[model samples]
Target: MLPSDPAAVELVTCGKIEIEGRLVDASNATLFCGISAEGVDAKCVYKPVSGERALWDFPDGTLAGREVASYLLSEAAGLHLVPPTVYRDGPFGPGMVQLWVDTKDGDDLVDVVAPRDVPAGWRRVLRAMDRFGDPAVLTHSDHPDVCLLAALDIVLNNADRKGGHVLHGTDGRVYGVDHGICLHAEPKLRTVLWGWVGERLPDEAVEALRTLRTAVRGPLGSALAEHLTRAELRALQRRLTDLLADPVFPTPSADWRAIPWPAF
Candidate 1:
């Protein structure tokens, strides 16, 4: 939806990856691979079966809708999430391509599994968020950030935020990738960003969130609204309002309480 040349695009296989086998034969409709496109430096592509929702178990417009919203939210959140690339029906089926980012510079919260695994210098990143009793800032399971992501995920109906959906760039930044399940009108938030719960957000961080909340309603929101339904747009606006109302360390939501098992 964000200025793309649908004509110049083509799907090319990436040799013998196990996933490729399932995709080429059509037995496995969803294929994940890395690509370098005209505007995209390097990106992971999610190709779903044309008109098929069985892969992620949602409706057709759901995935694409969410991708657009995520891009909007990233812009709103001051996050460096690359713009989403849409994959439509070619000779093959329906798939999606989007911008890839350097996770290292992107500030990934889930690059390490354990405190010991954290780079000695970056261990503070772990300690900084240890109050919630998790090493990683984000996870497939749930952390503060993951939970926040889930809220967006559920609002969009994104069911793909499972463990594998998150990517840790070599640059030491955690990047959240799969966004096919998104932009629904539901309150289905799921993800892992709570490692910093109770930890006061710095003044700078809080200010950034404020900027995003307002930006979403500006040109960016207007631009993205073109790709979304009226209801979806309203829903996004509502969510932003709700979050902006209370951008302090202690969120008032009842869901802010405890951490799940493995994370604790």
Candidate 2:
């Protein structure tokens, strides 16, 4: 389910979905479901388009489309950070259905920890005070997968990349989830993955961006047109182009909030 493998795609797209429960903390109606197809089965998340909460800033396609678009772009970028996602009809109506990622037990890639407790090999994004008036630092592991995700976030124009969205999968691959509020035509890159601002892009990231640049110019652009405006597609291209040209993680801008609220 990490990649858009043929089987993973069919499993999520052709499988029958039975809603198991609701993810109560999600802003939208996020259903935890059991998916099964021809003896293949897996857990998945279903988000019906009708359940989307309207936002003034993003007044275009359903959030479900944005998520599918994100998955496509992530694959096109060669990062494979997003899980297999398909936009389809569900019990409640049409929505985005994605294969669930089982996370590593007792493992975390991002956290808000006391400055003294910052782990080795972790990158610190910000230092502040917690709700209890204790010193805290926003940090994430320096794993290549996490770094690639940070790169992808910049191109996706992700409006939300909370700590809880980054997963260290049991499969040993890192994954990012909850991309409903992304791909707007504007620069809305709020995230907890800002730990590498101003750092040189990793060689792998440079290659991935190059791959994404070409994709944005070709098939990827055409497919994204279904979910994004021409303007949004153009914006996405510009982001990739700029990254390739600069080859560095960017510093946050003052014009907008750099990090999402409830960072976790």
Clashes of each: 31, 0
Residue ranges of candidate 2 with Cα displaced over 4 Å: 1-6
State which candidate has the highest TM-score.
2
- The local distance difference test score of each candidate is 0.46, 0.89
Q: Model 1 — which ten-residue stretch has the worst lDDT?
A: 11-20
**TM-score (C-alpha, index-matched) for candidate 1:** 0.57
Alpha-carbon runs more than 4 Å astray in model 1: 1-28, 33-43, 49-59, 82-84, 87-94, 99-160, 198-205, 248-264
For each candidate, C-alpha RMSD in Å?
8.1, 1.3
* TM-scores of all candidate predictions against the true structure: 0.57, 0.96
Per-residue lDDT of 228-259 in model 2, one digit per residue for the tens? 88988889888888888898888898999999
Best model per lDDT: 2
